[model samples]
Target: MPLLNGDEEISGVLRKYRNIAVVGISDKPDRDSYRVASYLREHGYSIIPVNPTLKEWNGIRAYPSLSSIPGDLKVEVVDIFRKPEAVTEVVREGLQLKPRVFWMQEGVVNREAADLAVQNGVDVVMDRCMMKEHRRLLGGK
Candidate 1:
C-alpha cells in the first residue's frame, strides 16, 4: 500500500523517529529547511544536514549525499527540501541508507519517487511540512 496521510500515521512517525537527514538544507537561518532542522534538533532529534555545497550547517557535518553519511549514524527519516524534479535522485540515494521514511517537504512531491520508496518497503510522506506536523501531532513548538 502507498503511504497514508492520516494523523495517526504522522503522529506515529514523529513519535518513533529520532534521526533525521535533512536534504537540501541551507546555511541561511531564514530558510525553511534550516528552521525545520533547527526545531527538530532542539526537540531532541539528531539532525544530519545533507548538502553538497557545504561542509557543515547549523554545526552539524553536512554530507554531500546520503551515501556519504557515516555508517555509525543511522538515518530514520530522509526529509527532502528539494524541488519535485530532484526528489527521485534523493529518494534513490536515500533508499541505500534504508531510512524508515522519505519525507518530501511542503510544496515538494514526486509520485514516482514516492512509489519507489513504497515498493522498497519504505513509508513515504509527500508535500507536507515535517515541522508543522511534528508540532501539531507531537505537541511541541
Candidate 2:
C-alpha cells in the first residue's frame, strides 16, 4: 500500500517537528540531500546528518548511522535520502531513535519499509520532498 497521507497530515508533522535526521545525506552541494537538508536547516529545522562517508556536515557532527546518533539527541523525523532497497535498514535503525515520522524522499519508496514503520506506530511518508512540502504547505521561505 502507498504510504502517503493527506496534505493536512504531512503538514501537521512538518509544523510540529523541528528536529530531523537526514539519513544518507551527502556532502555534495548539488545533491538533493544536501539541498533539502540545507533548506530545512535554513528554515529553522535542526538537521542531523546521517551519512557514513562524512565525518561532519556544515560543522555539525555527521553520524555514521542512525544508531550512531547520540542517545540524548532528539530526532523528530527520519528523512530518508537512500535508495528504496536501503530503506529497511534505515527504518529499522531509525525506530531506535523513536522518531515521530519516517519520510522517504521523492523517488525513494519501499512498501516493506513503509509497512514496518507504520506498524511501529510511526507516521510514514513516501516519495515526497520535504523542502517542497514545507514550501508549498506552509508558504515559501
Candidate 3:
C-alpha cells in the first residue's frame, strides 16, 4: 500500500504503539530529533534513543543501534531522524527489531524503505514528523 496521511489509521497506529525507538537522535536540544524525543518522553511514551555517538541523553541510556537495545525493551515504533538516503538501512534494522510502525521524519522519504516496511507487515509513515502528529492527534504538546 502507498504511504497514508495522518488520518485515522495513522493515529490508531501511534495511539496503539507506545514505545518508540528514536533513531538518529541528537544530543543537542535544538535539533528536531532531540525535540521529538523529548516530546515523546514527556508525553508518557517510552523513548529509547538510538545513537552510537551518545551514551545518554536527558537521563535516558542511549543505545548505539536498534540491535544493541536490550531484548526486553518493547519497541512499538521506530521513529527515524536520518536523511532519505540513510533511511533504508535504518528501516532494515527496524525490521529486525519487529516494531509495529516505521516512521520517517519530515523531509525524509524513501519509497524502497517504505515498501520494505509494508512488506514486512509494519505500518509506514513518511515525510512527517512524529512529534507533530502526536500533538495533533493525541493532544500532546
TM-score against truth, every candidate: 0.97, 0.96, 0.94
Q: What is the C-alpha RMSD of each candidate to the true structure, in Å?
A: 0.9, 1.6, 1.3
Candidate 2 segments whose C-alpha is farther than 4 A from its true place: 1-4
lDDT of each: 0.91, 0.92, 0.88
Better of 1 and 2 by TM-score: 1
**Model 2 quality (TM-score):** 0.96
What ordering of candidates by lDDT runs from best to worst? 2, 1, 3
Question: Which structure among the candidates has the greatest TM-score?
Answer: 1
In model 3, how large is the Cα lDDT of residue 139? 86
- Write one digit per residue (lDDT tens) for candidate 1, span 20-138: 99999999988999999899988999999999998998677899999999888999999999989999989998898889999999999799999999999999988999999989888
Which residue ranges in model 3 land beyond 4 Å of their true spot?
Answer: none
Clashing residue pairs found in predicted model 2: none
Worst lDDT run of 10 residues, candidate 3, spans: 1-10
Number of the predicted model whose lDDT against the real structure is largest: 2
Give the runs in model 1 whose Cα sits over 4 Å from its true position. none
Q: Order the numbered candidates by TM-score, best leading.
A: 1, 2, 3
What TM-score would candidate 3 get against the native? 0.94
lDDT of 3 by residue, 49-91 (tens): 9999999988999999998988899998899999899999998
